[model samples]
Target: MPAPEGFAYVVRGADVVISHHGRPVTTLRGRRAAAFLDDVEREDPQELMARLTGNYRRGNERQARNHPRNRGR
Candidate 1:
């Protein structure tokens, strides 16, 4: 399918993808996806850090509840 207006089509190996307003229109894979990620990295560092930190915090909370320190309380 053709990408919507204002969106750019990115071909990664054999797949086609699009991105807009700094977010990808859909999850893409392969070399093109990798390149897209690189572009995102170069464009936005704060948003990436926020996502990573949020994920880490969520996982840490799950792990903390299973730890011995909180096992009985």
Candidate 2:
């Protein structure tokens, strides 16, 4: 959904960087790197980071469970 406001990223070498308002928000890598990027582009920032980085935010629990795609298969 046009990415979250101020949310943008780039996959460089092996790292997937998530940024907001030109500031670095977080970096994701490993086998699920691409998956994380998809999350960044699709899910809300709160839900995406919560699921990928374990950084939770209030009121986002529901968003996490109802994420766009909940399966890794």
Candidate 3:
């Protein structure tokens, strides 16, 4: 959401280094790295990297917020 920001990546030989807010988070290699590169050119890089690094939401926030326990907050 919010057009994920502060995500950057680097191509290192056969590996792809992904960083968030300037800190290294995960690295993709071989087939994964190649796929990432190809997708980056056609998709939203920030969202892609966020998902790969486990930093993106799982689409459950709205439900959680509406749960009975969270009502009238």
Candidate 4:
């Protein structure tokens, strides 16, 4: 799948607020917030935010599509 887009983050005090397409999605606090800030600088920020917000691909679509229950579709 293509990389996600429209993800942005802002640090607020000890928290990190994540947004997608201008809408708030999730917040990271304390250690998680610290780690995210560090990683975002070195990795693809959009993908990272998508992951943090549980919006990234899980690589299971093909499997799901091939499952017996879904095969008829």
Q: Could you tell me every candidate's TM-score relative to the true structure?
A: 0.27, 0.47, 0.79, 0.83
Pick by lDDT: which candidate is best?
A: 3
The best candidate by TM-score is 4
Q: Is candidate 1 or candidate 4 better by TM-score?
A: 4
lDDT of 3 by residue, 1-73 (tens): 4777899999999999999989999999999999999999999999999989999888899999999999989
- Which digits, one per residue and each the tens of the lDDT, describe model 2 over residues 15-72? 8876666778778788677777666577675556545544444566667777768534
RMSD of 1: 12.8
lDDT of 4 at 67: 98
> How would the candidate models be sorted by TM-score, starting from the highest?
4, 3, 2, 1
How does candidate 3 score on lDDT? 0.93
The residue pairs that clash in candidate 2, if any, are none
Over 1-73, each residue of candidate 1 has an lDDT whose tens digit, in order, gives 2222344445666554554555565545677466656766585533443332232134467688899999997
Q: Tell me, what's the RMSD of every candidate? A: 12.8, 10.9, 2.7, 1.7
Alpha-carbon shift of residue 61 in model 1 (angstroms): 42
**2 against 4, candidate with superior lDDT:** 4
Model 3 compared with the native: what TM-score?
A: 0.79
Would you give me the overall lDDT of model 1? 0.52
With candidate 3 superimposed using the best TM-score fit, by how many Å does residue 50's alpha carbon deviate from the native?
Answer: 1.0
Candidate 1 vs candidate 2: the TM-score winner is 2
Ten-residue region with minimum lDDT total, candidate 3: 1-10
- Cα misplacement distance, residue 18 of candidate 3 (Å): 0.3
